[model samples]
Target: MPRKLSRLTLKEQADKALREMISSYRFFPGKWINVERLAKDLGVSRTPVWQAMMDLEKEGLVEHIPKQGIRMAEMTLQMACDLYTVRGLLEGLAGRFAAENISKKTVARLESILKEQQQIVKDQDVVEYSISDFRFHGLIYDFCGNWLLKELLENIKTRSRPFVCDITPIMSGLYQDHVEAVDALKNRDPAKAERVMRRHNLRMRRRIEWTLTREERE
Candidate 1:
């Protein structure tokens, strides 16, 4: 007898495959991805692949090019600036909320994340460091107790992953900013926390600007 196919299992498989493709730059920025070839590579049929593409499209990671099928969404300096502007506002609000409502347990958890981040920086493990960076903001969003803000930040994080990952190498100053932000949270100073968070995001925009300038010159 043949094995039964599971819809839930297949969707999960497709989601994971799509995430890997996006994270690894397999579906590289500005490049058209052949869905049929991707389906074959993942050992699935076109149906699941198409489903995964739809999910990615909803997250703004993939674009439908009409006759060209699907392509990775390209990043531009204008997009980066616009994203960072929104992020600064949302994340600054998160920091302020955290300062007001942060528990001792949450502070401890933030410290632990910071310690791990410090080690990753010392080891020069850029990939792990970047993952930790994501987790740090995720923790703040989760602790803020605002479901809507949390979901929005999560979506923006997914959409911005390619640009963020591409710029991880220029993040040496980020660790100190994290430390300062956490310290502000510990002190329960919402204003200070918001300032630190805004400055951190502005730094990210600056890095993106530098990268765009270099690309333009090239």
Candidate 2:
């Protein structure tokens, strides 16, 4: 006989379904959430669905208004700037920590990912390449020796995906940054590794700032 699958409570089921819908862009950012409709769609009661939205609200994936109701979190130009700033700071620290924990195996895995990223570029798949791009940075955080940092970065990526794709260009120049970061780790240079990672994210931040500035002008 097959093993019995663990059963989820109604609230847990609703929570899982809600997260999937949000991540898949089923609900666009800032769109007002219809709890009754969502409950019906998920085959759950409105109470469980409402509880789930409250949980997502704490994760910064949704918002609750005073009288209007709930909505998906919006990524304003300023918010984009702030997210990249945190990404740079945390990922830069991941670089430093990873350098301290560097090993031949880590270098090998990073190099392997870089080769895959190259193939993604050659194949001209922007979406696939974007995923590989995140994988490259995420691998560093995995080896950064801080579980909390890794969890935080992963959460940020999950929430930032739609916004990042819309606002940031995935350039060949970013691929070069990955190469340099791995090389720094191979050379066992903590400062340089951190610097390269920070620079990589700062480039994106600069672009966000430029857009924000231009919008203010317009």
Candidate 3:
């Protein structure tokens, strides 16, 4: 629940900061992240930095090699596809629950977010769209009323950052998908909402694959 490092314990604060940096692609995949340098950069002691690294290792975002240093985990194409597949399944469940339980006020708020998403996409504002996308999905995760499911999905999403944060795949098609998914929720159609949300994520995997294929050809 704590978004800011100041709200966490010292070790947790270090973990949160370092996790943000890694997930944001500040440390590229497979690059060695020096604990000492990171501590200096983060203005924290090496102890907390080490502690944070351990936490990240458990999440598979980073790994400690024997006699080497901490390196950002390498994301294979298979891993990326798998991550999106699992995300689609989990978020599909979230969508189903949200459709059954979401309030009218929440539906209105989601529509507003979708409107902002449309404008952001039109403007080609990737950063703003990413934030809006997170908010849109996060609301559904919360409204689903399944705390364990939400936590599990959040962890998987965090693991997904190694791929999602670094890629610049085409996103123009997603705005409409978001629109349709929101419309399903507005109609209180659980089956349609789940199908739409799952399709949205699965299509994202395809876009990512297409981007990779093009890169290979290039």
Candidate 4:
């Protein structure tokens, strides 16, 4: 017999479904999401779906219009840069803390994520690789033991979801940065880990800007 799956509450289920939809570009930036249709598709009531949208809104990913419904927020280049700037600082601290605090098991987890990421990139599977990318950074935040830091990072990451594809051109370099971060963490060099993490995010900002510039040129 198969193991029983754990049940999620209506709101939790709704939120997870909605988040995946948004992340996969099912709900594109600046597009209005139909509350009733989403609720019906998710097989949940409007109340829970509405609650989920509100939660995403607080993360700066969605906005509630007075009578039009929920719209996914557009990530302007400035907004992307600002978010990445703060993410660099916060994740730098998180990396420092992780260097001091990450367990051997956590190190193994990070390694596994990187291994998967390598294969994903080799296959040029951006969608699968993006999920691994999220997990890689998320581990550091989770192990950092700073509640506020984790909260802020989570919010910014969610807010940046729509723009993630913008950095695809430099995905290989991004993975290399993750590799260096893991090395720093393994060595437990707090300063090195912090610096590498900051530089990693800074590079992401630069890559996004480059991508935008090329897009404008085209």
TM-scores, all candidates, are 0.85, 0.76, 0.87, 0.88
After superposition on all C-alphas, the RMSD of every candidate to the true structure, in Å, is: 3.8, 4.4, 3.1, 3.5
Best-to-worst ranking by TM-score: 4, 3, 1, 2
Model 4: how far residue 164 lies from native, Å: 3.7
Models ranked on lDDT? 4, 1, 3, 2
**TM-score, cand. 2 vs. native:** 0.76
State the lDDT at 218 in candidate 3.
92
lDDT of each: 0.81, 0.78, 0.80, 0.83
lDDT of 3 by residue, 1-218 (tens): 21333534779889878766754547767889888877776666688889888988988889899999899898877887888999999999989888899999999999999889878878888767876877788889889889998998878877776665422355677887788888888888999889988998888888777766666689
Better of 2 and 4 by TM-score: 4
Off by over 4 Å in 1: 1-6, 20-27, 37-44, 164-170
lDDT per residue for candidate 2 within 56-146, as digits (tens), equals 8998888999888999887778787778889888888889999999789979988999999888767777666766777787789889999
Query: Model 1 clash pairs?
Result: none
Q: Judged by lDDT, which candidate is best?
A: 4
Model 4 residue 1 CA deviation (Å) reads 25
Q: List clash counts for every candidate, in order.
A: 0, 0, 0, 0
Clash pairs detected, candidate 4: none
